[model samples]
Target chain A: MVTRPPVIAEWLVRQTAPADMREALLGDLCEEFVLRGSPGGRRWYWKQALVSAAQWVPASLLLLLPGYLLPLWLLDRLWALLLSSIPLKEDAVRAWPMLAINLVVACLLGAAVRLPSGALVLGAAVLILAASVRLPLDYCCLFLVLPALASKWPARKVKRV
Target chain B: MKEYLGEFEQLVMLALLRLGDSAYGMSVRREIEARTGRDIAIGAVYATLDRLEGKGMVASKTGEATEDRGGRAKRMFLPTAAGLSALQASREAVARMSQGLELEGLVW
Candidate 1:
């Protein structure tokens, strides 16, 4: 009988994988989980999930910066001007709009970053910082794992014959 | 100069060649582990495959859902003609690079 894989690992994959890829990728993980078929295998699965995340997440974010930074920076300045004019009295409430922008940007970052937990957390922090300053996070950049972030790319033709 | 496959990409492709028609993410990972004694993450494998697919070096098909995988379908992979050609080119490049090297005493 196949034992259940670790919850956190599964959750990590679900959180980051592209919708088009989720089912198949999860199936692959589960298939492996069954093949190893032991408690140690569950640990093995967790290690795989975390390790992959560790390697890819920050790397993707960093790799894309050269291509993204210029545009994002300029746009951010314009956004700051827009936000500044609507200033609230308190820093706390002022922070809310940034936080809101950060969270939305963070979620969008999550959608594109197929790297696991560590990457997810790091991506969120980076986006939050960027968004707080009215900067943009480039969700479209595909530095290393180009395919993971290119689910919506019209050019990616996956022929299944 | 021809593009060289990354070490892991070459390994995954070689694994696909061995697995033949049954190649999917799970078997490919196990095959590599068995042969190379390296524990690779499934995500890493898929990421590479996805990139390869993007590059038109690999192709995949989604198979019927299986109970063992909790009703999730498998994404089976196979090397494309270009993929095989690239692999061979990479292998030849490695051989060409090592052709005249004198390595008899390099290792202790």
Candidate 2:
């Protein structure tokens, strides 16, 4: 790594965008980072990272909202129906199926929202694992069912030749 | 009617348009910085470019990786038809709206 960006900032950008875009964006940032390799270059890099995250993260969340809501509404209704019909105990046996359902819904919502699965997985894992010490399975399902919340390039469309 | 772009969006599109064939992520950022003298984050620019592309206002293609960028390809941005039209329209709208403003003492 002759000239590299801050590792964490690069990681964050990688997680924010699609895989295909990561290299280009990181390269751009690194090029600038190298160019600004004066006394405050590291500070400048961090400033750019924080400001950029501030600008994008909220907007990306807004963009993902519509795609997320429809799936969530449908999933919630289905979960309700399942709960009413099947009054199973709150154990791993019941939890596993719900978790699986959440994962599927999460993936679908991820695709619908144009968020990569890697981001969705990373976000949910953090939310679930970090809070697992104090949270129960059903509670953790909330995080699991969430769509990926980051900016991404438009999904490719198919055109008939 | 479609919504008009914010100030930053217009600047970005203008940069891409101005850059022509050379409009990649870093170049666009530099264009904005040099022209406006306002420091901007490259991530923020990429994020907004991503959004514009989402709206079909801007499009991108991957060019060959260059040695200077650590073997990473450049994601070049170009304005779509809709983007150019939006930018033109937005400029015209602003000109129309500010046609009679008393700006004799304000910052240019």
lDDT of each: 0.68, 0.68
Worst 10 residues of 2 chain A by lDDT: A152-161
Each predicted complex: what DockQ?
Answer: 0.66, 0.49
DockQ of 2: 0.49
Q: Write the per-residue lDDT of candidate 2 for residues B28-49, one digit (tens) a residue.
A: 9899999999987887688778
Cα lDDT tens digits, model 2, A70-98, are: 46556766786786687766763543335
| Clash total of candidate 2 | 0
Clashes of each: 0, 0
lDDT of 1: 0.68
Clashing pairs in 1: none
Among all windows of 10 consecutive residues in model 1 chain A, the one with the lowest summed lDDT is: A140-149
Q: Give the range of the ten consecutive residues with the poorest summed lDDT in model 2 chain B.
A: B62-71
Give the TM-score between model 1's chain B and the true chain B: 0.92
Give the residue spans of candidate 2 off by over 4 A: A18-20, A63-97, A112-161, B1-3, B106-108
TM-score of chain A of each: 0.50, 0.61
